[model samples]
Target: MAAALLGGGDYELQVSLSEALCRLTPRKDREQRTNQWFSSRDVSRAFCDIQDRDFEVDCRHFLNYVNRCHGDQRRVHTFPCLRAFLDSTELFPPKDEKLEKFWVDFNQTSECLSFFTDDPQVPSLT
Candidate 1:
């Protein structure tokens, strides 16, 4: 995250990771176990690919954002990369552990699409 930015990791990858961050986030107790498991797996995979030197730092940054936004329905600004995403999406229906929305906004709507996939031929975490 912030510290990793200093290491000059792949920008697009970080952006995608940020996007995956949003997608993988679960809707708390209300979130479906199946979806959570799948999304977690996908997110973890992408996260793991980051350089080992930066993984721990980035993970800490990502988790900090998550923790900062905890209990926040909108979950806005959970990551630095989320700013652009937030502006492009619809502003309604704040997301929560009970509501999973990815289309409308980072954490506002529960319509997240599967992102990272192990195989191109296979569908992602849906």
Candidate 2:
């Protein structure tokens, strides 16, 4: 799956993740405004790391970080699939008013991709 994404064979996942992050962490007018940051390099590193380590654990930790930042009102974003997984499993941390605002704003952003309907057929990393 990672290979397919990185190799350009899985553009849908790439697009979905990218759109999700942007929605979750829109850049502020000024720099150093938010705690969330992401890039292709970070995603690639995370993907490779997950391939070698415990994907569930890594994903949990990663999502926790993202949720924490969101709660803290930090301007950060993470992978959409991770967020979706967290939402589905109720794994997100206790809600905070500040984070709720971020979540709402994040959700308001345009959705550029849809993993829910794209039919990602990759094998589970576990």
Best by lDDT: 1
List, residue by residue over 1-126, the lDDT tens digit for candidate 1: 322321222333335545454445533422343243334544344344433345434544444333343344333223332222335542333223322322211332332321221223344568
Residue ranges of candidate 1 with Cα displaced over 4 Å: 1-64, 76-110, 120-126
What lDDT does the true structure give each of the candidates? 0.36, 0.34
lDDT of candidate 1? Answer: 0.36
Q: Write the per-residue lDDT of candidate 2 for residues 1-126, one digit (tens) a residue.
A: 222222322334434443444344434421221222333444433433332234334443434343343354433233433343433443333233323211211221334322222223444589
**TM-score attained by model 2:** 0.23
Q: Candidate 2, which segments miss by more than 4 Å at Cα? A: 1-51, 72-126
Q: What lDDT does model 2 reach?
A: 0.34
Clashing pairs in 1: 1-58, 27-97, 28-97, 100-110, 101-109, 101-110, 101-111
Distance from true location, Cα of 52 in model 2, Å: 3.8
TM-score of each: 0.21, 0.23
